[model samples]
Target: MSEKLRVGFIGAGLMGHGMAKNLVERGFPLTVMGNRNRQPIDHLVSLGATEAKTARAVAEASDIVFLCLPNSAVVDKVVLGPDGIAEGAHDGLIVADSTTADPTETKRIGAALAEKGVAMLDTPLTMTPKEAEAGTLNVLVGGLAEVLERARPAIACFGRNIFHVGPLGAAHSLKLINNFMSMSMVALFSEAVVTARKAGVSVDGLHELISAGALNNPLFQKVMDWPLKGDASGLQFAIENALKDVSYYNRVAADAGATAPIGATVQQIYALANAQGEGKTHVPKLMDVLGRLNGL
Candidate 1:
């Protein structure tokens, strides 16, 4: 453990904070940057992580840098921007990008990093910050076998399940598809809940009936937590993030010459929610938004 590779983290938001803490707890000499969220960065600093001033500083201090940003745009800005990771990166530095970003952008970035002898691994994550804090997240990785091996030890500190999906950008593709499916469920179930109320079916009854049948799933339980228990804490993901993922998914589908009519409709549902100013709300509260729309 004394010879462990040094690690750097660029985002300290909900999920990033938890993962950064796990790295420190697992004995990685860690560096972190204060993003829009400061609490997690401060907390991590208290627990022995060096607080860097910029992404470049973070890269300069570590063997591998993890980017858990909002999307490809932000990720690109932080990684390739002035004083970004690319500026401070040395040859052989590995970047494990955990942001749910565009696969095309990932391939492009990976190519850019290649010239500097920097390796980019698309290591998008699943599950929640709850699992992140517990060091039990499922990490989908896309990179060469050797690179994944290099990242595995540190990733295992916070990731319970690590799947080396394919080459660069594959993990991001899978993540976007996964989010498309899950976010669509959140939207579908939210509508069903609203319809149940309008049609005189109690929310509890609907939940119980579904729980008794095959329709039950972890996603359902999380989404229904709001309508059934007045808690959206079960799913901490924001609606804005959901919209971004699904939009990314749409790009993935279109690139493959596929028609995602259902995905298109689902995207509109989230787009309306975002336009209605529910972007900052958690996914579960979509029930409330749809309810108000239907006069429920």
Candidate 2:
């Protein structure tokens, strides 16, 4: 509630915008940058939040800056590029990066911030865009206990569940593993459904039976639910993002001297989808691709 705790958001995409709105509604001094998607930016402005002209401007205007970028490349550019936060950041500024990113890069940024007395918390988030809009995101945080404590209230504004997973980069590592599991499940189910349809089983019946059985999962209800209703585009999450996450997951596993055979195979399927130019399509688009492959 003091003037020293202003919060700024660097990305205003699907999840970023919702989190920013929650901060503003919670009475936090909020500043946000505009993105390619202007609707969310405009909405946040309507909520009594100021619009920042650039990533650095957001950092310069606030005490804590949150980066919700898509990947490490964008995160690097925003924090280290010309007019980046590292240049404009005040001493002791707390940066909470919510991107699902590489742990090594996270540590690199955290170490850089340390010299200036700034703190970095790699707090990646999970949940669909719908959950983000509902302020029910699950945040996995990795940082010093005291730093995470300082970030808790702001994090709680947008996340219904928040876990202090471990030290720096731990949250990102766990996020990669979690996404790999999710993507792998979608791929596995896609293959099974395609085979079932070919064998004269009803897709809707299979879904219903599975939902009533042990093989069911929340994602089946989420991605496949409306697809069952004949609305192909209701999921809204693209395969391109899934592929990106799996690729990141691969790197994390390789770094840890581990091999993820299932994850690796799912990445290949996603790679095939990308090659077929379905990268922009949602995860459920796999059904469309599978149907084509089956000559359905």
Candidate 3:
């Protein structure tokens, strides 16, 4: 029988914790790196997963290293900086980055890793931390088909809906495009809500009209309902992260020489929210940010 792969996980925060837990529970020999918060690292350690001192250590101790960080900048720093994955990576080692990153950076990192005989795959994730916990997150992969097949089992531990989008940086590019549309919708929705409220329209009435129409979607429901219930925690994604993704999207559009007026507009709105100290708030709370901006 073939042996299970040795898996190392970096970034044991909201989304990473559940993903790491499933890898360990699925019989993989898992090693998790320490993060700012000890609770997740301690919890993973208690589940028979070993803890590593640094990203390099985690990479050295495992066959497949999974990164679930915030943005491209952090991903770049962790994989290419001092004491990073590149330092400890060996020939034939696979690095799967699950962060929504810049496609250009992903390509550059993939090239660097390739020179060292380390294969880098862009495997950006969809869904939320809730789905991450349930082991049903959606994974969009971009790399060699054979490499994806090899990593499929471990990825399946946390992802139920997985798609091999294309080669190298395609998945990250698609992720940016996807996030642009989603965030744009949320921004437009928030603006509509704030405008309606100013005109003395009921928020619940607006929700009812939209919910009963073809415009309703799972994302719309999630962004609206959670906030209405006074629990924006259901989304599990921060406003700053949303801004980061939209900014990445704008960059992608600019590089492609395509005009992205709406994307640019959404980016500005998120920037405003972040400037108002709502960076750490959940994405759904953009409603509150917009409301406050309008003096509501």
Which candidate leads the pack in TM-score?
Answer: 1
lDDT of 1 by residue, 92-111 (tens): 79999999999999999889
Ranking by lDDT: 1, 3, 2
Task: Please name the candidate that would achieve the greatest lDDT relative to the true structure.
Answer: 1
Question: In order, what lDDT does every prediction score?
Answer: 0.92, 0.85, 0.90
Task: Give lDDT tens digits, candidate 2, residues 1-296.
Answer: 34437899988787788888889998999999887788998999999999988878888888889999989888989988888888877876889999989888999988987877889999899986777778899999999999887778899988999999999999999998898988888787788788888898888888889999998877777657644776645466678888988998898888889978877888989988988999988897687777778887
- How many residue pairs of model 1 clash at the backbone? 0
User: How do all models score by TM-score?
Assistant: 0.97, 0.95, 0.96
lDDT of 1 at 187: 90
Off by over 4 Å in 1: none
The sequence of per-residue lDDT tens digits that candidate 3 reaches over residues 34-97 is: 9889999999999999998888999999999999888888988999999999999897799999
lDDT of 3 at 34: 92
- The residue pairs in collision within model 2 are none
RMSD to truth, every model: 1.2, 1.7, 1.3
Q: For model 2, where is the 10-residue window of minimal lDDT?
A: 225-234
Quote the RMSD, in angstroms, for model 1.
1.2
